[model samples]
Target: MLGLTQSQEKGSDDTIDDLPQWRRVIPVALGLCLAFALALLFVLANRAADDREDALGNQRRSYEVIAIARNLEGTVARAESLLARYVVSVDAKDGQRYSDQWRLAGTLIENLRRSSRDDPDKLRYIGLLRDSYAARGKTLNDIALRTTYDQRLGALGRLYEANRTRDADRIQRILTVIIGHEMKRLNERSTLLDRSTMRADRLAGSYGLVGVVLLVAALVALWVANSAFTERRYARRLADSEARRVDHLELAVQNRTRELEVANGRLRTEMEERAQAEESLRQLHKMEAVGQLTGGIAHDFNNMLAVVIGGLELARRRISGRGDTGGATTNVGTSGVGTGGKSEHGRDTDDAVRHIDNAMEGANRAASLTRRLLAFARAEPLLPAEVDANQMIQGMSELIDRTIGDQIHIVMEPGAEDWRLWADRHQLENALLNLCVNARDAMDGKGTITLSSGQVTLRPGEINDCPGGDYVRLSVRDTGHGMTPDVLSRVFEPFFTTKPVGKGTGLGLSQVFGYIGSCGGEIRILSKPEQGTEVQIFLPRSQRSGEREASRLLTEAAMAPAAPRRSVFVVEDDPRVLAATVAALEELGHHSVSCDHPAQAADLLAQYPGTDIILTDVQMPEMTGPEMIAQMRARGIALPVLFVTGFAGDDAEAGLLDNEHVLRKPFTLAQLDRKIAEASSAPARGHKEAAA
Candidate 1:
């Protein structure tokens, strides 16, 4: 899931199957060309426009200077017209005023001549004309200067008139020269205009070319837009196809998920069935081992019993016959009866009897030990009940503390009154005691053991490495020499032990494990060497009321015989146990036949049809006891078979005990009697099918 999130953020696509190679290059090339061409065109047009603007400005300035010269001449002529006509001729009558006027007119005419003198013809004519006018002006001025009589006045007047006429002729010559020059200049200007018109035509041609390029660019832009639209259409199709592929992929994934779910469900069912079959096999194997061990123990006990019975009978008969040994009573006091407690010889007899009684007591203890071993192996049914776990701890506290000796202190941390658990009371107690003993041994009986109980609610997905459920937890904590990591790692392994020889039976913890597992509970251990150790047992809550009621019935049954003895056919591959079971059944007042295999018993059943029940060892090398029974039932033999098993590999013996008539290894004569009676009291129940 995290990987999926990261992949989404990175925009990774799994589906890009068909992409065109050419689609990538066209747009990139087109964009670069367009940009470069546009930049180059802008630079060229800007330079051309700047050059044209400069040329036009220079031509306008030249025209403006010419116009300024023409305007100055007109201004002077207007002023001359006003001065000559106005003022009532006051300045005309005065020589000085007249001289000033003539000087102004001469300067004005000189300026006009010079301004128009750029043309070669105009310069020569204007110069000649100016010289003629100067001479005329001099003549007139001389006449005006004359101081004579009337004749002289008349002469002076004639000269003035002649000079005036000459000046007029010169002025006309100057006007003609100026006008010709103006006309020649106008022709030159027309030539310049013709050149400008040619340049304008060339400019118009270039502008038309620019307009054509602009039209081409517009057309290219339209084509590019159309190409882009086509490309967009192609891209849209690709996107749509990719989207459809994704949808198909999603649908396929959903189908695969459904298939996977169905597979998982089938696997779960198979696993449950496998577990039940495995457990049954384990129980059967345990029962077979028990049968062998029980036969051996029983055989040995029976031999001892034979010696005792024979010796007691011989002694009784000898006493009844009144046989006296020589001086056997000589140690009796002289008063005919011993008064000093007893004579030395008499004390010896009493001592022999005590030894015999002690031997019998040891035998009884061995039988009791056998019963417990069988119970742990699951040969017997569990009696479950609602129990205050804290109270149970309190009840067992003294015994557990005593077992560890005074070196270790045992503490009971009782939970509040609300703490309750449902389980087999005896089995639970045994499990707790086993843990306490294990803790005590780990501590070498010198530390403290605390037994505590509590209830816990588990949330979903929180397993504590155990299956999730409402559980009552009973924990045993010890301040003993704890287990190292290496030791702890394999602590739960069957037959694993660290204790010195004869100090421990490795079955202690294995039994606890099996019992808890069988009850749908779990056990966990935590330990660190030199620090401490704690073992927690978690049992799921039970809601069934029958377990509680059944518990009471079991307790009462344990007190007395709940079954009656009947004829039994005991089948075993081991000679010792077969003989022992036969002997034990005989002692228990039942008719019994002993065989080394269920096959042998099968033959007997065919021949006699008188065997009331079959008691068989489960794990035989040739054929398992359950398999033998299955074979027998197939053959129409209807006798019920009770299995006898040992605690070894009890997990493999569960199937044999499913018949509810198995006796565990090293059982007392009483347990064998009970099982045989249970088998004979009812018609044989059919074999249970393996759980599906």
Candidate 2:
């Protein structure tokens, strides 16, 4: 019995040794399983992240492509608009702008091509868009070339034809298709991104649960082992390792999220920049259109004012016995003048004359307003001459007093005696008058307006954009309510006014600004909330003694005897203007022959080869007056030409006939007589020279 008991004890000891080995194996196996699970989860998570990133990248690319396509459409539209304006204005700047915008469109197309390189379908659309844009670009180029060659009418016609044909529409449609395709791709990628994110979330949750289960299994296995203490230490070490792996996964996710945020920030910035560019383009277009519109309306308005002013002056002369009948029968027509001899009712005639004078005053004021509009549009033809600022202000003092009313006081601070400037004298007077009127309005017609002038030497950056030079500074300061910073900043903007509607035209300051700029000068305004406003006009100093020469010419013309009667061929388009001009010529003691069309003027001149002078309108249908004159010169009919126009376009077009004399419409009889004398006395040019 002792030997058997010893044998059982030996077997128990061997089993015990084997049990310790099993405990080590079980814990090690559990740790290995946990490690494999964590590694596999990490790999899966990394793969899911990569897939999401790819989806996001695709979405971002699609958005970029879409934005580019939209911008390309807008660029093409802007280019076409500029081309139309170029045709209308015949401006070199507008033509250059069109070319720039078209080139920018080409660049956008290239960007679209690059963005769509990965998609065969999108690439095909881009190719189509490119071809269409190229075709349109060629058409626009032809129009611009025509305009550059001075074929404005032909260019305008072609532009209208292109619009009717919807050439630009094809480009728009192609862009729409491109944008739509990108949007679809973007939506699909977004859906994929959402699915990937959800899958990653689910995988993470599953991996976390599995890891927890594995951790519990490892702890239970360690507790069940024979050598629990050593096994527990090993299990704790495995748990720590698993936790570190989880930390590593979380860190990688945070890094990816930060990268996404940075990319999104860049995208937002790009979108904002694009928006700002679009807004600036829109503002430019709006201002350009407004200027063109203002010019057109002012042109037509001037023509009507000519008829009114001319008719009124004719009526006044007849009633007041100022008409130089010169023993010739007067044919006044429907100009509110009687065809009989002087009326015996002298008092009634005096009343009639006074009424006509009042009418003339109002008509002249309307004409002045149109001149301001033309000036603002940069379309007025400026006849610049040397001017003495002090003399001009002195001469205008009385007119300013009468214009500003008795309540407002006028203070004159004349500048140097030799402070002369080269500018349009009449326009300068109008500018001063406008400033005085604005001051009077600002002060509610009851404040002191100091009109000061002096010679100033300006340095670079010393004043409002005036170059370093000697300038005649003319200031109009008023003790009135001043302007805020916001109002002051925009004071020079056209059609911007702080006054109530109808109280002001909003063009007072704008006209001053444009006129000053045209004279190669600068204008500055200084104002405070309650300190009153001061407007300073800096006109470039002229070296010539224009004031004395101008006075001499005026004295000579005014003192000179009446011109001899001669045959005047008047070429006018409007019948009313034609009749009014004929009456004025007759009133000036000259025989007048009238033709309503420029095309007929050449034939009429040939028929009346004894014509002493040619009086023609500048702009007419079928042919311009200069063109007709050229034709006449071609046929060896170079009688001195006098151009009559209400709106003579810009300075370049106004001076088209360099050798010919120009007489603005809405003229007084004296002005008409003076211009006629000037035209007749201007040495006639040979046909060859005139045509050239």
Candidate 3:
């Protein structure tokens, strides 16, 4: 097939070069000239049609104005006739009909006034018409409310004499004068409109004649062009068919050429695939290395935080407990032992407690930063609730003010009624505080922070890049120095900041962005250099229930009466945290058996079978807290156990971390007491059910 096609293509090509080129040029040139003439003629015809349409439009407007003027005159005459008829007959029906006519007249007059508002002369006459109508209406109202004809029969002659000089008669005379003046002006306008319309008709006819002449000339030129092309066609028909056969042969040759190219392309593609596979392997190895580094660093860092935080709490207790008589060191923030406990040793206890409190504050802040890092790493889980954003803002009002200090002003704006938001309340507060603090720094501690919450609707291709639906929009606008485009672009990038070292972790806004995204919300920032910045976050509206009921139960349990003191078995791998837990439980008026390992705690659990609760660490060397409890339960130990962990556990770990029994790490003494109370009560209910 290839050999036959090549032979035919060569034969056709050898015979085609003999045709004359002049055969094609003459028709193409004539056709172009013909097209230009026809296009010109089309343009001229359209222009004439447009002119005729515009003239007709003007004529129609003139007719509308004349019709309105005549209607105005008729409305006035109708009202006058009805008014006179009612006065003569003194019939209630006639008077009501007259009132209706008066209202219709007022409407017609107002229509005229609006149409002619730009005309000074027409405006003056419309004003006169309104005044005359009002005066006549008042006089007629007085007459309508007056006595009947029979009651006024004795004074009928005197009333008739007085009615001649009344305001109604004067108003009637003025209306007649106004109507006459308007009719004259309307006639003059109609005359001028007729003249303009006639002139427009003449101009349209002239334009149409010129257009027809152009059309005929363009047709003649096109006929000439067609004749010239036909004459040239006679000279080229035989050669054109021969050239077309040659083109077909050339097209077949191209098909075989493309087939040859395909085999080469396939070879190149295989080589490219091999290269891509090698690159992918490298990328996989890099990701594995990064994951190992990140996980190891996080685990080691959290263990160190636990040690530091636990040691501070223990040392502060011992120093203050020795001189902590009368609970002088019990004041968490304001326990100036110098002010109240004036003993020498009491002052030392106060200093120790204050220093530890500051250290604890720093540790807590570091813990918060760690939480953000975990969140960004997708290792943390959120405890979202059906929270009313407005109420949340109000709850944090005082805390925000104090955090921002007295140099700045704070404003709280509530959302609309009944709008519900779904988010973690504590994380949302932290994000808000971070924004406020950033705002304060931008203003150099001397500006205002505006916090607002409201329900907003977003549409596809509208405000806030989100799916079209209802959303809760919370905004933090600051009257402080803003950021440039470059800074704004990277504001939500982890570890990117413009703040000086030691001043910012640079994870504040990034955490906010990640957390909002995790909750199916979007955060947007608007900023300009030297101007202020506005951060707006939009969360999807929720109709979730059962959340509030669960929250209420937790609150009630936390604040309700303390549970009875009983033995607590504690298991922890960290000795410091384990010691702190035992001391906290003992301080809260309970006996505690503490163990540094799960094996020891299990032995203690076996010996002391009368224990009320077991508080255990989540990640232990011998066994995790959940694993140990499962072992005990396998042996038929049905006591309620609380699993405490510093890490943000996953969904499978949720059964152990039921907000009531599972205490998070770095919890205070008060938190321990509350958890114990709640945990003790949960088991007591189960025992009562068993007895029943």
Candidate 4:
């Protein structure tokens, strides 16, 4: 009895396995059959729509031909009338009138021939129109020869006797028959267009109905697919949850076993050390707790320190001046430390001043660190423009070669003509330089780095995988110690680096990835363990101005203008930032009309037009600066505008960053100075068109 029950259970398990196979096969068969039917239906519907459109086109062409034929007939009639008048004028002995009518009739016939040149039916009518005109001309010529200046009355008599009137009547009859034939052809075309339109309407209605049916089918398929996907996801989640639970239970059991083993070992050790280690154990426990607390604090401090140091460094570098580079010592007297504050006691006072200076130095270092982190994250707004990729590559080659050292051969193969790609040129240059440096480091300063750029046209299928289009490819190939497959896979992953300690931050590749992605471009890496790595970036090409010269403003003032001396209103909230901004403006030769907030700037704008341009930060405390610009414009102070801000959100102002009129922040004093002058130029005096 026990053997029989086991056999029954074994058979039931086999049946369960077989049930899945049948279920899969049934759905797969149904799916394939439905897909095949849908494909056939699509092809048939497209073909029918194409056929109907072709038929409508044929009817339209037929109508055009008939209309042209009718026009030819009318022209022929006008020629006949003019020829009859010419004959009558000659018979009456009026040479001027006869010559005028003859010339007019000739023009009408030529026009008719030219008009019907393309259509076969119209060309046939044109031929008849020409014949009738020629016949009339011949009859007129006979009359003109018969008439003479000496015998005026006899000329009139001879002109009538020549039967020119009879020939004119014959031409008119021909024109009438031609016009009738054209009218019949026009009627036929009208019938055809009517029938074609009706047929097209019927086909359109049928196609719409079919489209509705297809749409319903598509909706049903989507519903089924979504249902299946949801079921699969639910199953996966359940599986994952069960796996995680099992793993947790297993880990707990292992941990408990480890604790037991440690306890047993300690028990054996305790017997040996019972009389000699009470103080040591107490000290060890205290050290462990302190270490954990210290580690937690250090981690938090490290993150904050990164932000502060990065921000200050960015601000300091972007700030322009002569002595700003060699630390704050050179500017101690001239930049605003009082004479009384100078040290007379050499060591004590010196130490006091040194501490304050050290504190300031610490703040600056912290800001610098934050800015670097921000750059890696791409939190700053990028100013993208249509750049000539070849020019930029060529321009950076010399700098790159120098930085990588003379031992490394840095080769640049830029395309002959300009390849326009939309990206921030400065950021792109930085990315390229970073890659070159990395390559140099990989080779230990002795390998070949080839930087090549060219344009590429992608086909529909190829681009679809990449969200594709025409792209400009910039490839960098290095003969260096290439990364292994495992390393290459995690190359762009943030904070993943294989460099020796103190040599890298692991953010270089991450920054490159972010910048390329921001510009709607893609980067691909191909590497082998001992061979080489090829990093290629595909940047979408700007199609509008292909092969044309970049419309870079020709005037020096437009591109890089002189410093502004006129009054300008500046608005920002950060205190140290405000002071730094004011100092930068003064150095730029600007008489700054300064405010700490946008509201104050708005009030100042309302009070002054001598304020040539408005320079304001976007993210302000009381009111946003964009709103302030709108308010200034409303208040009739439509002075030229410029924005200096670090806020780079996807908003209206971010979109305007591409325009020359909108300047981005962390700007140099020189850049701010240049923009101010350009915006503050006097308006043109008159409305007269200037000489080119």
Top-TM-score structure, candidate number: 2
Better model by TM-score: candidate 3 vs candidate 4: 3
Q: Identify the superior model by TM-score, candidate 2 or candidate 3.
A: 2
Flag regions of model 1 displaced more than 4 Å.
Answer: 1-361, 364-406, 412-445, 452-472, 480-518, 522-534, 541-565, 573-576, 647-650, 681-683, 687-692
For model 1, give the 10-residue run with minimal summed lDDT: 81-90
* lDDT, candidate 4, at 671: 58
- Estimate, for each residue in 429-504, the C-alpha lDDT of model 4 and write its tens digit: 7788788888888888788999989887766556324665778998888998799878988898644567764466
Native-structure RMSD, model 1: 52.5
Model 1 over residues 199-310: C-alpha lDDT tens digits?
5334434444444554566676545444434543554464456446546655755665575566557546644644433343344445557755764554444434433433
Residue 396 alpha-carbon offset, candidate 3, angstroms: 13
Question: Of the candidates shown, which would achieve the greatest lDDT relative to the real structure?
Answer: 2
Tell how far residue 648 is off in model 4, in angstroms: 7.4
Error of 1 at 292 (Å): 15
Q: In terms of lDDT, which candidate is stronger, 1 or 2?
A: 2
Give all TM-scores, in the order shown: 0.37, 0.56, 0.42, 0.37
lDDT by candidate, in order shown: 0.58, 0.76, 0.64, 0.58
Off by over 4 Å in 4: 1-379, 461-464, 544-599, 609-613, 617-640, 644-660, 664-692
lDDT of 3 by residue, 126-242 (tens): 687688678766655555555244332222232343345555455445545555655566566546545544544444344444445445656765454444334334323533453
Task: Return the clash pairs for model 2, or none.
Answer: none
Q: What are the RMSDs of all candidates, in order?
A: 52.5, 12.6, 35.5, 41.8
